[model samples]
Target: SAGLYDEARRGWLYPMDVNPAGQNAFKKDAWNKYRIECIGSSIRTWLNGIPCTNLVDNLVSSGFIALQVHSIGKNDTPGKQIRWRNIRIQTSNVKPSKADNIFVVNMIPNDLSAQEKKEGFSLLWDGKTTNGWIGAYKDTFPAKGWNIANGELSVDKAAGGESTNGGDIVTVKEYGPFELKFDFKLTEGANSGVKYFVTLSEGNKGSAIGMEYQILDDLRHPDAKLGKDGNRTLGSLYDLIASKKIANSTRPIGEWNRGFIRVNKNNKIEYFLNGIKVTEFTRGTPEFNALVAASKYKDWKGFGMAPKGHILLQDHGDRVSFRSIKIKEL
Candidate 1:
């Protein structure tokens, strides 16, 4: 609610919906200075004297920077103006002698940190283009209904339905035994999913079948109650195994949330909400077969038994954005 499209006053939550107009750390009718710095692979932002946004991203090594002024609206004051002063540039290295004494927000978008590179992790989503993904059913990306802007891959809102318009999208390459991480932000009453082991061979009438890490508005979506127990809820193995819901784990709607899925050499699969492990299971087990047998995927041939498959992002006809999509082969 804080960042809900009021000229960005609420502070940007993600790339798509930011209320950057009204809320500010500076005086409303006063002057302030801002400093944006990029050091090696790290980026940090400051408002007044407070640390606002900080993270490590590698997509932007060098580029032109631009400042923007919001347009005056029809319902606004005529004489109101936005101004900036003391424009400065520093090319010399400034070694920090000490740490800042304020909260630094970490918004690492579409980047691989040095530690991640050492750990053999790479970005799955390049943050600027749809290079590694394609429409789940089609050979190309959807012509409409999906958007890529400001380092976010977002599905635009449409007639609410599953795979009806832009359809689902999937990775071009298949993966086996990997650790995947992404940050997702959802609009109100949205329903989407991050799917793994997606065998594109399925010629079904709808989405290519795969095991999904369910994303939903548990408080607002009806699908939350349709699956067995709470398996269809957020962070759950959709309709098969329920994620153990933890207190203070999932952020509320409209705020960014972190998701993790790991499949190991031993064929062990684990899911996480934020950084907490919420579900775990082994693949191709008798118990796994029995669970799939009782679930909605009972009719799909060889469900969840494939050795490797593409990852997918479901378009549930609601606005949802994803960023910092990175993965590491285990």
Candidate 2:
């Protein structure tokens, strides 16, 4: 319980599962000082001068603090005890603890942390506007089958056929060597994708042509089994390579999961699910070309080899929510 918790969001924004340092900082028979430093978007915590949590979020700017004692658990003794003392609060001239190399958990959707900003990252989707996005093969954001609310941009379910509803949306600008980060939540049986190298040149009859980072419900979506060797499954390089199984690399359906696609300056592409690298391949290589040549895109010359192209979000006619769409050019 010695961590950063966002009461407004009803979730722990830092030390998500376990913080070994924080756990070791606790003492059963001795009193220990608990410290928290929150400044703007940066939040840090410590116990007995040992760093516990480092986080960046903007959800709650101001709020009151309260104490709580948990109810006894099934295995607990009837009256296990806890206490607090010397509780203090400061508003002005509060010096934030210096940040270390510890990873920072960023929970604010559609926003970037100071580190991300310093690393050249910028919002691709502003979380509330479609200014930088346009419907595939169209001049504006689609008027149907898409919803923007509560800091999420989502596609509405319709016929469950690819591009039959709001169709696909693509970034107005193109990118080649870049790193993209997004958070996505899938409905049961949903199918969608984050595509790169999309040229929007294949006649626009369906989702824009691109190298897809597949987003699907592996247990409920048929497409998860349609492609060879799970290539169409979640976090895959869609048809070209399968997303390898990584321990706890995927969140449960209906929960948000981080999706990352890194297109290195050398044309090597990587896909990460929940911060775990699951797939990687270099474009235009013999191995990559051989995979493409045997997949659905075999007929498309120079598929996924474009020097630069627009980033796309597929509207496969299923509900899928996305946020925190940010990117950094390499």
Per-prediction TM-score to the true structure, in the order listed: 0.70, 0.75
Candidate 2 lDDT over residue span 1-330, tens digit each: 467654534344454333455668867688988888879978888888877777777766887787876566798877667778899999999886654544445677777777667767899999898999999999999999999999999999899998999999999999979989899999999999999989877884777789999999999988888879989999899987999986556778888887888899888888877655689899988999899999989989899988999999999999999999999888
Give the true-structure RMSD of model 1: 11.9
- Local distance difference test, each candidate: 0.77, 0.83
RMSD of each: 11.9, 6.1
C-alpha positional error of residue 136 in candidate 2 after TM-score superposition, expressed in Å: 0.7
Which one is best on TM-score? 2
TM-score of 1: 0.70
Residue ranges of candidate 2 with Cα displaced over 4 Å: 1-54, 57-105
Per residue, candidate 1 scores C-alpha lDDT tens digits across 258-289 of 78888998989988776557889997899999
Residue 147 lDDT, candidate 2, scale 0-100: 91
